[model samples]
Target chain A: MNALAARRRHPAAIAILLLLGLVAVGGAYSLLAPKQAQASVVSAGDINTGKSLFLANCATCHGMNAQGSAAGPTLVGVGAASVDFQVGTGRMPLAAPNVQAQRQDTSQFTQEQIANMAAWVASLAPGPAIPGAQYTSGQNADVAQGGEIFRINCAQCHNYAGSGGALSRGKYAPSLTGSSGKTIYEAMLTGPQSMPVFSDSNISAQNKNNIIAYLKTTQTEQQVGGMTLGNLGPVSEGMFIWIFGLGLMLGCAFWLGQKAA
Target chain B: MTDLDTTGQPSTDVVHLDEGHHIGTGGLPARFEDPGLPTHIHRMADDSPDAGRRAERQVVALFGLSMLATLVFIVAYFAIDKSVGIFLPGIGSTNALNVVLGVTMGISLFGIGAGAVHWAKTLMPDTEVVEERHPQASDAATRSAAVGIILGGGEQAQLGRRPMIKYALGGALGLFALPFVVQVAGSLGNPTKALAGLRSNLWDIAPGVSPIRLMRDPEMTPIKASDVTIGSVFHVMPETLKDSQHVLEDKGKAAVILMRLDPNQFSAAAGGQRAQAWGYQGIIAYSKICTHVGCPVGLYEQQTHHLLCPCHQSTYDATNNMEVIFGPAKRALPQLKITVDDAGYLVAPEGFHEPVGPSFWER
Candidate 1:
């Protein structure tokens, strides 16, 4: 090591080495810089457009300050992620309010309009924002590792395959099969509805990516059995076993008895 | 065997014979006729030598395949990585190791069954025999003979004559059951101690000790009062549980859910004044275990101030001192009384006054 330090005295070599180091740093910055930009982009939108849209469409129920009214719950602290989820999914500008907001066929607002509304609401109190573009990038995600993470963090409420299950009262863990990579990440970050927030402090960004990968993989590849029987698990499996297996056995016994007689 | 006559009635035509022995006069029938069985047909494998050889080879091949599949299963079990994915026709992608192991094991089991069925059908004996059915009831003389044989057996053994042997056998049989009885009795160890442990969990603190600190579960970090937000909920465990060997057992009893609500919304329901005073500010801690079947009650509706148990639809109103507002839970979730120490960290001043988790019949 001492001999190597004494040998490296060439000016040309030093310059070349410096250039290579600069290029490496530049390459890394280019690779990583877009993610930071994308996060800022999530929080950037026209505040005036957002306010005008809210007053015209939402203020009647949510109130002018968006602190909730008798008709609607407070949206003050609920943030951009909640707005993106509620409005992006077309569950917000509810047609005729009901027990629970249902997913609609098409979102009434455009993507730009949704972004503006999210920015306005987010500016009010500063809560959990929608997951940045890096979360949904889906690069270097290990599907198998994701399966393990999903089983631990999600399977209790959502079914083992992200098929969703009933929770307490009228609530249910919605299926992740239809959820986009962004939606699933945002839901984990923001904890929409009664779901508990799995913050970055709890589940890291990389772990969240793994979970999204697992969800996407499950959407394509589910149970490989001849028939799934609705994938309700034990209830369907037990019913099929009792009815089909017993019926076949009983038929065989009857046939054998007839032959004997 | 009685032969069926043309009139479909049984006729006695065969004579009974006992070689080198005289027949006892027990009033049994003297003669009966043999009832013929159906004729047997030879299979192709049995008739033809070449067919028989082919059948033998097929059975051998099946057994060989079975051995090969078993070897494959064993090799796959060790060599294949569980995470490796394989795309199968009609099945889509699945764990390669599981698929290989299942297929090989299934083939191994199926080969044995198929080989046995084929061997039985082609090579095994196919003979029909007719056995005569007699009256189910025995004659009075036969019954008496059976009783006499039993009596003869007793006399030969001389059990009645040997009092010592009789008593020894009786004692051995009686003592044989003691081990099982002792095991059952030992399993039900001092019910009072078990009940006391259930009633007073790890949070019960014990006498002359400082108040137990409330730590974040899994993280085991002490939580400050300022850390808790209005709508936020924390899954907490006692600091004493951090180094305990029985973490799961202790955590099951000691797990508490800490939630903060508006002070104006707090209502004194069942516990009244005492329950209201136990809370620190609007922040209160209640047993995480549901009163109905003891599921962890984690789901909280911040808007309604309802603590929901996932196992059952038991909703506890945290604002009303964690009263069971809905579902099958008849009793309220027990509240943990908490206070801040000089360090400004949350601590359990005293243990839960009432038993935590599902209620017993004695309660």
Candidate 2:
């Protein structure tokens, strides 16, 4: 604190001290607490009716505790944000199990029902709740830094092309061409599917934003040479060369080497 | 008297064979033996006893030297280390084993050749050979005679009757042959243990801790909820590999991909239209570890919102549930459920919904 701060502190010392103490506590809370976007409130009407609707509709497939069973993945730690993203978009209430989960229409869950389901999921595990579908704060913190971070962390499996690849079994890691920074951050906040959670501890908010900037900047840039298959760097690119490109080259080389002169 | 057969000198030079002849005298061969043939030059050893004994001893010494060289080759083979060279400050490091073994093997083979040539030159009959022209096909009688001639040569060698000479020659030849077997097999016995090292990598991020929080690799930094903007993508991973023995140095092969999308755009589960609290506001994380052969799936396209695996152009739709959109990968990247910790940094709510790394289990 400067001289002015000291003077300000001395004047209504008790209240100022109390205020300072509160700010300190807030800082600590902010560190641990999810600094959620201060979006508009969920209407009283939706939440009030959503409670009972949730009990009746969702208790069967998902456990009453909201812990997943044979029919579904556990929803204990998943937040309303995920619920809104999944249900509001109609990816939930899947028609059937398959290689990839598909998005469908949202008429099945009424607004109140959707709210209640989100609340019920929250009851099991309190996480980032989804506001309607509106998103702000798409601006990233940095661009050049993000590129460095991406190269070190994401280049291995995701490839330089942003093309996804296979993992053990049928699981795969997807690309991030047009995804909003909010979704990217939330996904980090809440690991959905097979993606692990990259907590703020792992990658600071500034670093995450930097990564976002890198992704956005590169999207529209004109690629120098046209073809970039997988871009998973060596593993994928090498395979293409070995299987098709190199094979063709080798064939030509063999012809030249054995030209019967 | 000496337990040895004494040879009778062909030349009766008991008194004097003058300066005109001191052994190795030449004479024409019988006409029936070689018609119009050159003279048969007689050597001093054929007619003199002392000179022949001297030549025999010289051949034995050559064999003895060969046996000594073979012994040294075995010593060198067993002593050299086939270990990788480490950097040293001043005197450069080279493959010591290669140099030592190469020199020893070279010496071993060279000595044998030199000794054999010496034996032929100084001990064995050095006279030029001339074979009579005959039909290619041999009669049984001639075959038997050839076998008899070989047997007679073996007797002449006295490999068995001369115990000292036989043992010395055999020892030399036997030692020469043994190092070859040792040379090839000596450096090949440690593979079973080495193979296991390549199989199971040190990527386990610890145990008991579910959903090891994904952290930015290398720097070990944390991600914040407020930082990510809409229409942006971030590649992320767990903070600490406490649940497993995850090492940062190995992240080049094990990182994951992350992106955020509009909630409305994201597909809901069959459970409802409302999205699960999977994202803070709409952020999602996916394994960068490719589902197809485990390549790191990256190079995300912000416009198309596609995750592309550089390996085979496999794309994953982030708007959907990370389903494979294109290319060879069969499944979506495993997702790690996450939530904010007390410090507001994103942390794994639980471990990955599915295992991480490659499709190691066809099972």
Candidate 3:
């Protein structure tokens, strides 16, 4: 209203007020620097939050303490590897129990939430975390040893030929022929289907790497004298040997006798 | 004067014979009746006294050869170490003991046969007799007579009383069976069945320990939450399985498959339902071990959301409380309630609701 009052409320005063505001913010930041000033590294202490979320959503089956109750397994030491593989891909909080926990879209938990949960789980049983999308451990796996182990432990189900096999009911052992190392690693880590969990306690990470190496070797070396027929196994192999090899020999013998005569 | 001139030329080769008798030179077949073959023959042994003695020797020799062959067969059975690979040059077969036993046995048998043939042809009484072939089935009289012949032969041999040769032959026969006995009883010592089974088991539900992880076979790495995608299938286990600590082996049965699904589509497990706490938002887990035979029920169909077992084709409907959807499995796979721990990893909230793998009769 008055000319003098208007002049006093000028742009300079506004600029000075802005400068004070900036200084106050800078001072506050400096005071709290050690405790609150970290980079965008998001290793939040969200495990407590995750634990609560787990009890609310997962405890019904998993139990309140995550110790496992009726209709669930004991989660004493499954590790972050299992947690990440299960929830990261939305296989956890399964739609329902099937031949296996089928992988689907629409994860219920966010990546961050899942991470928090993984951290908590890892605390219980510290072990291998989820493998990266491409697990490229260039260590050469011993194919012969792998084959022997495969035959001894996995052949009955996955098939000696790696063609995979059926399980009781409608379940089946999956084929390892084309699975990427990541997929294989995740599958082992998560135990997504009717598969049981294999903690690092069960199979060492090095052993897993060796197995992957062997798989790679086999994927390349599968070619042999023709007509594998999915290698349905010894019975089929025997059938082929008898039908082709022995049959030809018999025919030759018969021809020879006739010619001699 | 007439007889004196001819009498000087008396018979040069003449042998007297009885009424129905004949003589043979037992020389080359060219001089014999049938000239095709010059068979092994006996000379004066074809007649009386000396002939009988020769016949006895030949018969005894044949039996003795048979005994020797059988003995050799037994020796060959035991002589070859099983680890040695057999190589046969003359024949295609290559089993060491088989070849050696077979050759020795053939030689012994051949000697026995030759000895017997020599005895029968040269020394057995030479009288021509004929018997008529009749019906396929022998009459009672014929059968009895045959029995009588056998009995008569045995009696003539004085087998029971003589004891020495009889006992020796018996002992030889008994010894011939020794190899088979050794094969059966001796081989029983090595039982690989139990060992092989333990070597390849999928579940290890023991007691008082952490338990082995239910790891995916081949690549047996432990699982984490982030790796599983919705509609993804996983074969899982505990991390404890890889540990060297013996105690973890006890609770291997606790392995479970944790999965998440859309909660609305999921069906609660059947059988007098209690609290609807078997699953989470959609996450549900079950034992990988089959409830029937212990094959891992790992085949998962994402669209159908079904778990299929390879062994007997048992199916588990994940949305329906892990119930038996198909195949020989009598019970549903045991479900395990699972959740993320404070650190954001997958963990079983507790042990399985029921025993894993096969449902025991005791259950």
- Model 3 residue runs over 4 Å out of place are A1-161, A164-212, A219-230, A245-261, B1-228, B238-255, B268-276, B339-345, B359-362
- The per-prediction i-RMS, to one decimal, reads 6.2, 17.2, 12.9
TM-score of each: 0.68, 0.34, 0.38
Residue-wise lDDT of candidate 2 within B1-363, one digit each (tens)? 121213323444444646565554333222323235566565656567776777667656656666776677678667755664423233234455555555566666655665565455444564558788988888999999999999999899886688899788889999998799888887676666544432432234346655445565556557666555444455564554434454553454446555666667666653212223666677777667777787767655543466777667788777666678788888877665566777766666654555555555432
What CAPRI grade goes to candidate 1? incorrect
Off by over 4 Å in 2: A1-45, A52-59, A88-90, A99-116, A129-140, A227-261, B1-216, B220-363
Question: Which candidate wins on lDDT?
Answer: 1
- Please, what is the whole-model Cα lDDT of each candidate in the order they appear? 0.77, 0.60, 0.62
Highest TM-score, which number? 1
| lDDT of each residue in B179-248, candidate 3, tens digit only | 9998998776655653443333334335555433334433555455555545544546565556535533
lDDT for residue A259 in candidate 1, whole number 0-100:
19
Tally clashing residue pairs in candidate 3.
141
Index of the highest-DockQ prediction: 1
- Quick one: ranking by lDDT, best first? 1, 3, 2
- DockQ scores of all models, one per candidate: 0.06, 0.04, 0.03
Ten contiguous residues minimizing lDDT sum, candidate 2 chain B: B1-10
